[model samples]
Target: MCGIVGAIGSRNIVPVLTEGLKRLEYRGYDSCGVAVLKDGALQRARSTSRVAELQEQVQADGLGANLGIAHTRWATHGAPAVHNAHPHFSHGPGAEAPNTKPGHIALVHNGIIENHEELRAELQALGYLFLSQTDTEVIAHLVDHLYEGDLFAAVKAATLRLTGAYAIAVFCAHEPQRVVGARHGSPLVMGVGGVDAGERFLASDAMALAGVTDQIVYLEEGDVVDLQPGRHWIEQAQAGEGGAVAHVRISEAQRPVRTVTAHSGAVELGPYRHYMQKEIFEQPRAIADTLEGVEAITPTLFGTQAEQVFSQIDRVLILACGTSYYSGSTAKYWLESIAKIPCNVEIASEYRYRDSVPDARTLVVTISQSGETADTIAALKHARSLGMEHTLTICNVATSAMVRECKLAYVTRAGVEIGVASTKAFTTQLAGLFLLTLTLAKLRGHLNAEAEASYLKQLRHLPAALQAVLALEPQVVAWAEAFARKDNALFLGRGLHYPIGLEGALKLKEISYIHAEAYPAGELKHGPLALVTAEMPVVVVAPNDVLLEKLKSNMQEVKARGGELYVCADGDTHIHAEPGIHVIRMPEHYGALSPILHVVPLQLLAYHTACAKGTDVDKPRNLAKSVTVE
Candidate 1:
């Protein structure tokens, strides 16, 4: 998914828009651009590098615009290039342009406009000219030809021609004092306050407008807003009747820009010698940051509407893609067993396409680090369409479209996760999901005071315990030297630990490009036993629990096959290591919750092994940050 931001105020807007884009870069960062209405004319610039390049260019000149919009483009219809970037204009299409001898418009969009090709062919048939090979270019053309001095109406009319998801921001040369914004399946929000000169801002998330204005409100799907310096109004009419037109007042607490601390800690090869080793050391604080404000959650946390939705929901459908999907799978089992409710876990990519069994009583919970994951967003929309009106999300990106579309939201404060293979995100999602389970149990009166108190106590101790486990990363790195040259590996676990084995295998595959497979310990004999050999490394997730002895038996099976065993066991005594078996005795045995601790070593092993292979850990091959496009 892409990120978009717009601002109209007496203050210079180009700098504001660019800064906002930086704050929202985590949404998607393939390319970036900015379009500003300045001096009664439209000025635009775009680039295909990290946002830093665009920021460098913007700073080359005095950055200033009373009204402007910016975008961080994630490739959709075209490849990642300057031409494919957003802020597309209507220069050629018999449409008004910057050279239209009068006026032009620049538009930046986040979601895909499904009807772009058809719209482009229609415009071409109408003798309209075209510029870049982008779906967004159609909007610039439509806005220009359709504009009759009313920008909002032109946007409203233009949106009618498009299908699929979108959150678009538009600016026109003739209206330097104004801006227009609209959204459909995609998410958008506008921060509505300022201290000096009443400088209001529009951003994809509260992060972009953070420090500038914490008082922000979101624009719901199918909602549109018109902007003016210090004030704005809603576009009372929409092309579609599905989304409502309403005014929501936002307060300062709803948004906060974290004080970006400049860290001098450039990773080095001293002693422990890897970013993964260093990052592993950072897990304690990471868990704590994610736990911030978690206790405030109650049945009434989000208001009466959320309470009503929670009360009425008979079951849950946890939808996600990738690691978040794995988190959902774990939550599904937890919700059913602990919360005593039924749940269906679906990979978001397949959710909307399948003949989903959904209804009004189902609450669809979409999980994603960046809320822009395309399939997840699409699934959320699909569920809402089928009358599953209650939607909630546990996401890292609070400003992400996923959070904006849903009625309730829970944010994981993992901060900037630069690695392509998620580490902290997985654990934080577990934390959030556990809380969600507790919330449901509390609401249904399934959890008594003693149970709730015990769980919360365990939850509170997570950060500290996570700290102790993270300190073991140095020891894990010592084990990774063996993984560097391995061709295939088998991961073994049981019970809740089984899903964790799946996640560990996934993390290794995602970043390291390793051929790894996971099997439930019992199922190891069923089929995967054929693959275990002297050369194949078997990673046994032997957390101390009810299944520990059964897992030990599986490890013994691997040893019989002469397979090299790397046991991530809870304690040394329980591991029963032979001459060939190596063990990493965990700092603590957290019982059923041990998977949360055991998963750490696997993440470190993946990261270090990938680093040893010289792979790009932050941007793995063919993998974009978020899968906004299918």
Candidate 2:
């Protein structure tokens, strides 16, 4: 995934593009570049550095233009370097000969072009030389080859030959007044600013255009747009009378344009060393915002139609990816036990590729923080195509494609999470998913008045309970010192807390680059016990539950194998410090909602462990905050 931004107006647009690229750096930060159309020519600058460094390069070169496109690239088809960076240029054949100048056309792309190899061979035969080993370079050549005095028509025609997914923004030296953009599978939003003779902008996400404009419109699939100084229009590919591709439908109506307020303040880092640390400490406020107005256990907390949909559905099917999938896996236990509903959790990327029997009465629930994950959206659509109509989403973005596609939604107020490895988003998702579980229980007549009041009171006290857990950071940091010297780690849990074990392992591996794995504590003797040794550190999420005795037996198995133990024990478990064992006591055991509290300490453990190892905690290598591409 990559980030893109464009601006076309009379003002110097370097500051605008630079600020937008800085905001969108969460998408990717391997390399960044910018291209501007000025003085009837194209000027370019690229760097294998952060956006801030790219801005310095632009200023050093003294580049300014009224219209330009910028990109922050995450390389896929080639290594990350200056040659593979974006703003790829294409010059038509015969222009690079003696006494001739090459044509100038620059483009920035976000996704992959599958047919680039075949097209590149064809273009080479036509005397078009290539530069850089990138799939994006082929698109610029194709667009330049098809240009016939109209930039918009050439872009649409070039896209007709493209396969796979992409969201591209192109600028032409021949036509300096326009910027053309198109999206097939990636996300793109157009922003309108000022009034008459004002400015128009485009970005991969609305957050990049926060202060630039409040009026934005999301582009649908196969939609293309051309932005001028004070005007823009959208067009979608449609079919003709004979089932052939016909003329696109161009729409310029202002009524469909939606106004969205930006939360730029939420993304600022306030007294923390990194964004990951700031986000880990933001869990209390984020959870409070997610559970703000819930005073009773009602189905309307999800949406108005949630009650109707819950009544008609017989089973729950959760679809998610990454950490969101682990939250969904934990919810399966809650839905089956408290709501008395059969539930199944599936990985979104693998769900659509397999053959499975679909039941029409099943409710499809999707979980995501950005709400723009490509695989999750595709899996939701695939489930709907199989005649499963009841759909719901627990998402953080209010205007994302998932919210627009689903029938019901519960938007979590987690604000903005910029860390590549999620912290607050995971806990806030559990907050929303727990609310969904309670709503289903009420709709299914499984909750009594007494039980409803008890659960609500417990949920209200979660903020204080989480605060107590955060006080154990010093203990966790002490454990982290021993962990930093180890190369492998094992995590264990049982019953409802098992998924928390999996999440704990994931967090450590994501940021620290350590070899970590998780297994159900009961399943240790089956296969994983063979790998335990004195050098391998074992972490246990030992909450006080009915399975505590069985979990303790497993902990003893690790100790019997001469393995060092690091236990996150509850206050009443009586699992005290002993030889070859270390215990960090939790304040209180949260029953039926223990995953939310248990995960916080694991987050702190991973953060401090990565810190001691001197790794990049915020921008982990080869990981992106938003997985907008498959």
Q: What TM-score goes with each of the models?
A: 0.82, 0.97
lDDT of 2 by residue, 149-240 (tens): 99989998888888978999998999989999999878898888843346888888888888888888889888888888878888786777
lDDT of 1 by residue, 342-396 (tens): 9999988788888966679998899998787778988888888999998889998
Candidate 1 local distance difference test against the native: 0.76
Alpha-carbon deviation at 205 in model 1, angstroms: 1.8
- How many clashing residue pairs are found in candidate 1? 4
TM-score of 2: 0.97
- Against the true structure, candidate 1 reaches a TM-score of 0.82
Q: Cα miss at 22, model 2 (Å)? A: 0.6
